[model samples]
Target: MRELSVGEAARRAGVAVSALHFYERKGLIQSLRTSGNQRRYASDVLRRIAVIRVAQRVGIPLEAVRRAFSTLPDERTPSREEWAKMSAAWQDELEDRINQLMNLKEKLTECIGCGCLSLTACALANPGDALAADGGGPRRWTPG
Candidate 1:
């Protein structure tokens, strides 16, 4: 079987070599090593890289990608059925995120209308300041 060098794989994958290294480190992709300790990747890795890039573009997390890839064999590209299954799993999360963004966009006008950024009155932005009770760290807003 033919194998590609790190540069060749990166070029074919349309990503930087550093990104490939990072993916390998993150367990999203794998590579073999030559006797000279040079990285070599199977042709199938190109397809895997394309999938990873698309997933990331659509806001899928690396952990999610890793989980999806864990179900596939390392020696081959993911089949259509595998891709469909992974995409279906991600669709729910993507829909939720879309809803959250829409909600936030709608609330943005209200927030601007009320100049006072008080948590008490700005229930749309921060309901009861519940995040404050968590501690003195950055508080993330969860979509209701």
Candidate 2:
């Protein structure tokens, strides 16, 4: 039942203190307050931080990561089974993404031989024509 001070956790987690604070606010991690109102976290938080970093590297959005973690217990440390389940789900997603990328690569290779590399005709190079009617691209939701 060891606990780490904020500085120690950030140093060990290889993340900035502010980032750690943001994670806590995002419900990705939790902490306890000391008498002086400073933050302290259980050693198990190191594992949570690692998972968050890996999830981000895999292109999983923060909101999705938060939702995935919601299925896990917060009070107790996660067991290997718990991690395995999450990893299994993520693996499926990665496989699907790989398939999509491979399909796109095949299409582009075919286009190369078809002399359709021109931006006006190339779906791979300029998707703007198809995407222009899709509400002007992805929306960036910012809090007002």
Candidate 3:
């Protein structure tokens, strides 16, 4: 079987050598050593690296990626079926996060109708638009 040198793998992977070393250290990817004790990788490594990059882009944690990889046989590049299963799992997580973000955005908008304290609608603090509540005018701070 043909193998790629570490440099070749990194170049094809579009990551730095240090990143490859880091991935190896984190068990996200693997490499074999030559007789002279140099790192080499199988062609499948490019696919694995692509998965890792996509996972990261979508905010999936490295630990999560490692766990997913561990579920695979020999931790090799996932087959198409395996990828579909994995992507479905990530899709659920992304949907949940997107919901949370949308909720936060709504809260932020509510809070800032006239500058409430971020996500907090503290009644004791500067609650939403005091002047707007009474009448359309400006409110002043006495500086306590």
Candidate 4:
């Protein structure tokens, strides 16, 4: 089997070297270590990286990708049937997200129309005023 050095793999995969390291750390990909302690990747890693990139572009979380990958064998590129099953699962999740976003978009207009705090329909309702239970101050800003 053909093998690629870390730098070469990163270049061919169109990702930073650090990103490859991160993926390996996350158990999303694996590498072989040489006697000199250098990382080497199978040529098939290029295809795996492509799948990861496509999944991220479609809003699939890394954890979900990891889970799906767990269902697949690591010996070779996923077979057509394997890909079909994985894609179908991702498709279903994407459909649910699209519906949720559409519903939110519709509600956003309504929310903008009225800033009333009384209506449960208020966009920032916080459902059951849950945020208030935590504290009265500003909540932490979570970065993407």
Which digits, one per residue and each the tens of the lDDT, describe model 3 over residues 65-102? 88887777674556889878877876876685577557
| lDDT of all predictions | 0.75, 0.79, 0.72, 0.75
lDDT, candidate 1, 1-91, per-residue tens? 6999999999888899999999999999988899999998887788788878877766667777887888987766668887678767667
Q: What TM-score does structure 3 among the candidates reach?
A: 0.69
Ranked by TM-score from best down, the candidates are 2, 3, 1, 4
Per-residue lDDT of model 4, residues 1-144, tens digit only: 678999999999999999999999987888989999999898767867888897787666677788778898887667878878877877876675577557666666666766555565575565434333323435431213
Q: What lDDT score is found at residue 69 in candidate 2?
A: 87
> Any idea what lDDT model 4 has?
0.75
Kindly report which residue stretches of model 4 are placed more than 4 angstroms away from their true locations once superposed: 55-61, 113-120, 126-144
Output the worst ten-in-a-row residue range by lDDT, candidate 1.
135-144
Those runs of model 3 whose alpha carbons end farther than 4 Å from true positions after fitting are 75-77, 118-144
Q: What is the TM-score of each candidate against the true structure?
A: 0.67, 0.75, 0.69, 0.67
- Candidate 1, residue 25: CA error in Å? 2.4
Better of 3 and 4 by lDDT: 4
lDDT of candidate model 3 versus the reference? 0.72
Q: By TM-score, how accurate is candidate 1?
A: 0.67
Best by lDDT: 2
**Cand. 2 TM to true fold:** 0.75
